[model samples]
Target: MPKDKPLNAAARFQKTLDFSAADYYDQCRNRTYACCFSVENSPYIWENYANGSEKGKACIVFEFGKLRAMLNSALNPEGAILFYNGNSCRQIFEVNYGLVHYVPWGSHRTNEKHLSNPILYTYLKSDRFCEEHELRISLSAIGIGHFALKDGSLIEFPPTLQLGFDFRNAIASAAIREILLAPGADSSFLKTELSKLRIEPAPTSEKK
Candidate 1:
């Protein structure tokens, strides 16, 4: 779809539904900005992606937008603080945006945390909800990958299907109050880790 077409399609979608004016507005917004929501005091849930162990109690949620903006203003940062599982075989993740971007450092999962690692990066094959979905991070060990549902519903993929990254940056793009980071992650660490990544803006040709 073209850049201008989404809004027009969204408008048409709204009119076809039997929703009232107010309800129609809400539905259109939901469709236009899928996976977006407020999380002022919303409870966060965390678990071992490889195992179902309860690790939610150890995580600390921060507004990603505020943190991102604040860190950009700083200079000579150290490294972002990230939660560690202390176990090599287990992977821990917050269930909100399906984060798979692991902080690289002295950790057991050394191979999984690198920003440029091919196993961690993924091309978005398809999405059932978000329109602005594309290349995502896939944490295969936990059965989660890119373009996965944001409603926190887990599904098993076929053994032959290789998964990609699952982190949700779009839904958390503006004033990301709902995105969850590891419990101990800090600005300095995030700066150091992010600086090492070969990230770039997606090309216009890739946007669906």
Candidate 2:
């Protein structure tokens, strides 16, 4: 696919879908921004090729778009927050289960919606998600306090999956929210943790 083809294809896809317009729109949103729904985690083992300085440890690479999706899903906002990288953000901590560390990865989409679709490949292959990152995107679908589904279903949040979507996003999501919003939360925690690894932008850097 080329830079100027996704919207046309997606728009065509939107018109041809069998689901409701809302579902159709969300699908388009996720597809156009795969990173918004997926993550690539790896052990911080100083694998410079993968984690240049982020080594001898463990961490989750929150896909930029995926992080947005997670937060949007949690916050239950209208559409994309339009959150771009380079814009300084505060770190939230003080929750339980440690989801507090899951912050947005600092990489922005250089091109427009028509340009090379954005992706988070470097972290995808960072050797974390493949091995231990059982990030179950399904958990993100419902039960999150921030997200009010189209069907009006607000159930209990699931336990946070160690790396991905293994247990419950509801519980994990709440914890994450607490951490980020907690009074004690600070930037040092995130900066120190983020600096531990060498994150790379998606090589393909495009969505399907």
Candidate 3:
């Protein structure tokens, strides 16, 4: 038997960024798509995630197609597009891209069985390679894993696009929230990008 260790943020971050393309895809071979879940209340999700608690909140089941669509859409300043009940959701997060791949499903060991369901992982840190580019962009990659719940439930996510050209880095939640709360600002570029991706807020839900 193996001992389960507590989740450490620093350690988790380190493990995720140390993978090559071959290493990532080899683990993802012949895996089936599982279910997707939504964290409607992000604070709760973050709190639980921060404490290393597997299941601290309830997640509403979401659509797999919608998740794929949003993730495949053009990168936005708001970060990755998350769908809540099939509508475009801005509250979505990039989930520490590297952590997405390295997380062990049932046990702490890294293996193919544990790599079944992978999602698009976004590297949020800003990089300014050229002074000509105005905005800093994060690199997007693919990963697989899920958040294990205490009650034997798992919240799954879909794979994000790994386009080398897409530079939309994950934006901070505070900034996203501000944009949602205050509708007016200089977001012409953002609006144009969202339109290109066919992303819109769910009719029933308020912009968050």
Model 3 lDDT per residue over 144-186, tens place: 5543444555444445422332222222112122222112333
Residue 168 lDDT in candidate 3: 23
Candidate 2: tens digits of C-alpha lDDT, residues 51-139 = 32332233343434444445445433342222213332222111111111132234332234433312222122222233333332321
Model 3 spans > 4 angstroms off:
1-61, 76-108, 111-208
Tell me the whole-model lDDT of each prediction, alpha carbons only.
0.31, 0.31, 0.33
Candidate 3 lDDT at 77 equals 41
Instruction: Tell me each candidate's TM-score.
Output: 0.18, 0.21, 0.18
lDDT of 2 at 96: 15
lDDT (C-alpha) at residue 53 in model 2: 30
Looking at candidate 3, the ten consecutive residues that score lowest on lDDT are 1-10
Lowest-sum lDDT 10-residue window in model 2: 92-101
Candidate 3: deviation at residue 157, Å? 22
